[model samples]
Structures are given as structure tokens and as C-alpha cells.
Target: MIRLYTKNAVLLAVVAAASYELAAEFGPWPALLTCAAAAAAASAAGAFLLRTSGVGRVTWRNRLAGYLIPWGWRLNRGKLWPIPVVSWAVWTAVCGAAVLLRPAPDQPALGTRAALLAAWVIDAAALVYLLGTLARATPGGRVGPIWKLVAVIAGVISASVGLYVGGQTTAALVVGGGPPVVVGGGFGLLLLFVVTVGRNTRWN
Candidate 1:
């Protein structure tokens, strides 16, 4: 279900990016927004699947527990604990930067490129951490190194490009032919990463 939906989401994103501003076609706005929504929903569904696929009910239930056991300190779960925090912090910083760079008073509240940039930064940080963590944990005995390499390469290049384009573009969303391409490419890379990680990992 999630797989088919995710594919559909990506397909929508691609089609939207390609047909924007045309006379009789759907615009990029719908495509990117749909992709963003789908990406978030798909990620959530995948995470739930991961927790329930035999990691022990205790582990799964504890995840929702309100107790702040302190992941990087008090809990002592894994060496990878700091990665989540770092990822979140990076995202927060980018968001803060965006707030600082907000557009003029007259622009649409949400049309402020800064906010969008912030969101992009947050998403990029997450993608980097999630896929990067999996790639790191991937052992040499089972999954080939190429999968991890693909994760790292695809994650970094696409994310950096997307963020850069988002940050660099001027007020006009369609002024430069870059933002849509960057995001579309980034999502494509992310889709690839998800597929590869799912295929090559035991945490399935």
C-alpha cells in the first residue's frame, strides 16, 4: 500500500514539475505539495512497520512512553543516539535562518521563501540522518557497499542541491528554472534511497 502510494506521489511530483505554467496542465505547486505530504505519510507508515516487525513489543511500546529516559545520556541505547539530535538541531538552525530571512511584509505569509527554505532544510537533515544511519549500520557481510555508497551519494548531492536552490532563488518562484528541478531531483534521490534501504536491510 505504502509502496504504491509513494510511487504515485513521486510520479505526481515529476509530472507536476514538468508541466508547470503550461496552458492545460496541472502546476508545480500541486505536485510538490502532494509529494511532500506523501513523503511524510509514507515515512510514518514505514516507521510503524519497522517497530512492529519483531523488534519486541517492549521496544515498540516504550517508544511512545512519555518518560524522558535521555537517549544520548541516561538511556544509553546506541552510539547512534546523537545522530537524531544532530539531525534535528541542524534542521532547527536552518529554520531559524529562514525566519531571519523572511520576505517583505506584503508577501503571502507562507509564500516567504525563508519558511519554505527552512522546511527544506529540515527535510534534508532528516533524510541525511535516517538513510545515513542505515547505511552506516549496513554490514559488509550482507548488503554490498554499493548500496551504502548510493545512499550517501544520493542523499548528499540531492539534498545539498535542493537546499541550495531553495535558498538561492529570488522572490519569484518561477523566475529561475532551478527550485522545482532541485526539489524534484532531491525527492527522486530520496525515493531511491528508501527503496534501496528497504531492499538491503534486515531491519525490514
Candidate 2:
């Protein structure tokens, strides 16, 4: 289960990186569309691969749940700073990429792509690591698989949008002069974060 979660996290991280890269090339809206299409394609390919790999026919719902970091809120309530830390780390990486990958005056080149991708991978790993850590620390009060899957799917989308907004905003502010309309996605991302933490935190 841990391995599965890690793999999915890695994949999502790749998705985030790729989406941001696309955003750098195209604009945010078009980059988002391309990401959606890519996600659909990747999901289809994943389904087919799982079906044929003798790994047992895992439903898409379960697969998505597997990708999410399970929140053992009750078990780890006292040590919850890590979640925010993970999120902060992601933002920090974005900041670094913005400055480090800032395009030149002539035209955007390929030199910064590798650095951005590396930063994205670190961001993804931080998220997955936090989830894995919490799951390992706590073994109780888990949400239902269906709910978990739903929460994670929404969270991933929100995260991706947030990343796009951050990446684009940084590029615009520091490097290029892109749009600053990240409020829609930023608000959604914050809301989802609250939802995930609040819903998973066991009060009993």
C-alpha cells in the first residue's frame, strides 16, 4: 500500500511538473486544458496497464484512493505541522523555480526546464512523504475508501491548479509578465486543503 501510494504520488508530481512546463510555453488556461486531456489519457492508460499486469483488477476509485495520502487524523493530531510544512515546501520550490527559471529577454529557452522539473519532483516527494509519514504513524480513524478517493481526486486537481497558478504567477512577476489571475484556483486550493484536514481530523 505504501509503495502504491508513493508511485501514484510520483506520477501526480510528474503531472504537476508537466502541467507547469506547459503553462510556461502556453498560457494557464490552455495549459490546464492540456493537463486535463493528459490526465484522462494517463488514467485510461493506467487502467489498461493495471488490468493487464496481473496486479488484480483494482477499480479506478480504489486506485485513486491508493494515490492519496491517507489521513490518520486522530492518531497524529498532536504532530500535524508536517502537513503545512509539506505545502510550504511546495511553495518554496515554486519560488525558487520562478527566479531560477526566469526566462531571458530574447525568448524562453530550454535551459530552465530541467531545473523546474527537478523542483517539481521535490515538491511532489514532499507531499507524498508527509502522507506516508502520517499513515505510518497512525493506524486508526481512516476515512472510507470512497470518501478518501473523492477527497484525493479533488485535492489533486486543486493542487495542480494551485501549482499552475503559482508557477505562472512567479514567472509573470519575476521572470516574464504573465497574468495574475490565480485567485479562482488559489481559493479552491485553500478550500480543499481545509476540507481535507477538517474532514479527516477525528474528534472522538
Candidate 3:
């Protein structure tokens, strides 16, 4: 459990940093669009990975116990809908919001900044949620070196590009320069390191 949490946390940091870097590089609007594309591709790729990794046989009834319990009282577990479907829907909505709400390249309006911030916060939360589901979906789900390579490449490139664009364009209005790159890049590297350290995890 500790290992899984650590891994997902690092993954979140990587995605956040990458999003900031990409934002800075491309500006918020473009970055978000790029992220929308990358995320879409990544989601497809992730599904494939889960199948290849032999962990994709997940249904809401079987999968919910692994992730949804963490939310505690906020979610009425008994009444909640299928998590896999809901999770994907949430990802889509968040991406849509990113596409729609990301501010322009120049100094944006206060409302734009506020809306962008809200979008990012929701994105981060969704990312963490999905990561948890991914982590718990497998049993002795040690992936191959090739998959690790994919994770590293995908994580870094997507994140750096995503964060760079996000930071420069949308988040810049709120968080400013230099810090975004530093934080994003730093966390990205940390994420890579964490992925390497736990290349193989088995709860048994």
C-alpha cells in the first residue's frame, strides 16, 4: 500500500510538472489542446497496456473496493455508479474544460485565471484518482522493461510538454515564471526516479 501510494504520488507530480512546462511552452490554450490530444492517446495506450499487462479485466463491482474507499464519506459507495465508466467520463469532462477554459497567451482576465486554476485542480484530482485505480487493478502486475521505458518516455515527454505549455500560457498568469519550470522539471525528474526505484511491485 505504501509503495502504491508513493508511486501514484510521484506520477501525479510528474503529470502536474509536465502540464506546467507544456503550458509555459505552448501557452494555456494550445497546451491544453495538446494535452487533450496526448491524454486521449495516452488513455487509449493505457487501456492497451492494461490488457497486455493482463490487468484490464476490471468491472465496477470488482474495482471499486480498490480505489473508491479512499474517498470515505464524500461518496456514498452503496449508491455510486460504475467507477471505470465514471472515471473515464470525468477525464473527458476535465479535458473538455481544459480545452474550453485555458486562457489566452497574454495576461488573461481574472476570471480566466480563476477558471484555469479550477480546471487544473480538478485535473490533478482526477489524475490521482485514475492512477489509484490503475495501481490497484493489477495483482503482481510487474510490467516489462519495455513498458517501463514507455512509461518513462510517455511520462517525461507528455509532462514536460504539457506542463511547459500550461505554465507559460494558463498558469503563468497565476503562478508566474521560473517557478513553474523548476517545480515542473524537478517533479518530473523525481517521478522518473520513483518509477525506476519501484520497477517491480507485488503486494504479496
Best by TM-score: 3
User: Across residues 135-192, which tens digit of lDDT does each residue of candidate 3 receive?
Assistant: 4445666645535544543454344336536554443333332333566789999898
Q: How many residue pairs collide in each prediction?
A: 0, 0, 31
Whole-model lDDT values for every prediction: 0.42, 0.46, 0.47
Q: Tens-digit lDDT track for model 2 on 51-70?
A: 34434456664455323322
> Mind sharing the TM-score for model 2?
0.33
| Full-model lDDT, candidate 2 | 0.46
Task: Write one digit per residue (lDDT tens) for candidate 1, span 93-168.
Answer: 3323333333434444544453344344434434544444454563554545545654654554355445444553
Best candidate per lDDT, number? 3
> Model 3: how far is 4 from its true place, Å?
1.2
Better of 2 and 3 by TM-score: 3
Task: State TM-scores per candidate.
Answer: 0.32, 0.33, 0.34
Worst 10 residues of 2 by lDDT: 172-181
